[model samples]
Target: MKKGLFIFCFTMFIAFASKAQDNTSLPAKYQEKMTSIFNKIPEVTSSAATSLIDFAKSMLGKPYVYASSNPDRGFDCSGFVSYVFSNFGFKVPRSSREFAGAGTPVKLADAKVGDVLIFTGTNPRVRKIGHVGIIYSIENGEIKFIHSTSGKAHGVTVTEFNDYYKSRFMKAVSIVE
Candidate 1:
């Protein structure tokens, strides 16, 4: 009887241990994994990110014209991004899709202000990158970006990485050292 009781107690302990490990929330586990992955990438200083962000902001209120890079005539999503980065003397890819594979990819959680945020449409029917933007800020742990959108806003604007974009977010690429 003592041996049977001991075996039962051991089985219960194993079950309890397994349950405790499985109890970890998915979000917490994801967060932990992201934190570790982000740690490997070099840190992006705020000053560097701010410099690129400032340039993008300077064109705020500019109209959004498809396939146009002319700031005076208005800028499209990729055009605006390429234009701004060109000013920094970096020749970036011309299309949003091209930009996706341009720089060293940094995870979204590790993205800094200057990192490039790629996205598909708000509805996200497509798997290709259709839009590009520069990370503008991280407010209250939320990532925001400055992009020229052809949406209702219809111009260069700063937007929070809310549910709309969050669901569409592809990945972030660090163009600046």
Candidate 2:
């Protein structure tokens, strides 16, 4: 069991390191810090959540297409979340706004992998659900999410829940218990 745990932790570290390298938006120092924190996370015991996150990661680099859910054609923010949950046999809201009332609400601090995170539109002043993503991981009290974004990256990517997102963050909901 000890060996297995070590291997898992090591593999996770390598994976995070590679992802951090790919993400150029964050400064070198921030990437290194995030990778270090990822290494210290306890082994995730939920197979279902792991599977969902893995699947979501597989879509990284896919383009962000507005009002579309097809992987081949790409997906918008809500479309990406909808497609991921639907692929896992979960009935989820198709639109971002619809997700406001879907699933059981989970506090931001207590959110886990596979939970859907809703956020307001680009203009946070609107105060309405217009974007969504899946919690990719939570380590050292920091949350990273996977979503199809039209921002700088312009594709499916994992993003840290930083100040920009915090201002737009509406709530998080658990789809897989």
Candidate 3:
């Protein structure tokens, strides 16, 4: 009886070890199985370009909070961008001004989705990147963007760069992947 118990325990231990090893050094057959499970999201937009849109869509209807960083708690303008991109593995700067430095500066005509839009409209006295938003789409010569606003309509909302946005438009930068 003692001999049988010893063998049983040893076999169990070996099986456990093999399973652990297989996790790291996965067998080719098991890897094929994993591919089916892994949702390989296709790149609708170029790298880093659509990360914001994907993150924002997932966060639709989240409330906006001042200086809050988490999606559950909602986010501020800068926090919203920071949380969204960072969640998708992109290293985004925390504040709006810092994030403005992350990408290449794109002209208004050259602006594309996933580009960071900076504005000085938030504070007139300041001629720097005061507010931030992510470009989502452009249609019929109209540009739409997603950003967290304060007080009214607080949360991530898609606003257009029509006359209203152009009035407050500062500049745009591209976060090249």
Candidate 2's C-alpha runs over 4 A off are: 1-45
- Candidate achieving higher lDDT, 2 or 3: 2
Instruction: List the candidates' TM-scores in order.
Output: 0.73, 0.75, 0.68
Using TM-score as the measure, the top candidate is 2
Q: TM-score of the candidate numbered 1?
A: 0.73
Residue-level lDDT of model 3, residues 14-66, one tens digit each, is 57644654353678778756554333323422756665587677876789888
Worst 10 residues of 3 by lDDT: 36-45
Supply the TM-score for candidate 2: 0.75
Q: What is the model-wide C-alpha lDDT for candidate 1?
A: 0.84
RMSD, one per candidate, in order: 16.3, 11.4, 11.8
The positional error of residue 171 in candidate 3, measured at the CA in angstroms, is 1.8
lDDT of 1 by residue, 63-152 (tens): 999999999999999999999999988889999999878988998877777889999865686777788899888877898889999998
Q: Residue-pair clashes per candidate, as listed?
A: 0, 0, 0
- CA lDDT of each candidate? 0.84, 0.90, 0.76
Candidate 2 lDDT, 98-140, residue by residue in tens: 9999999999888898899999999988898899999998888
TM-score: the better of candidates 1 and 3:
1
Please give the RMSD of candidate 3 to the true structure: 11.8
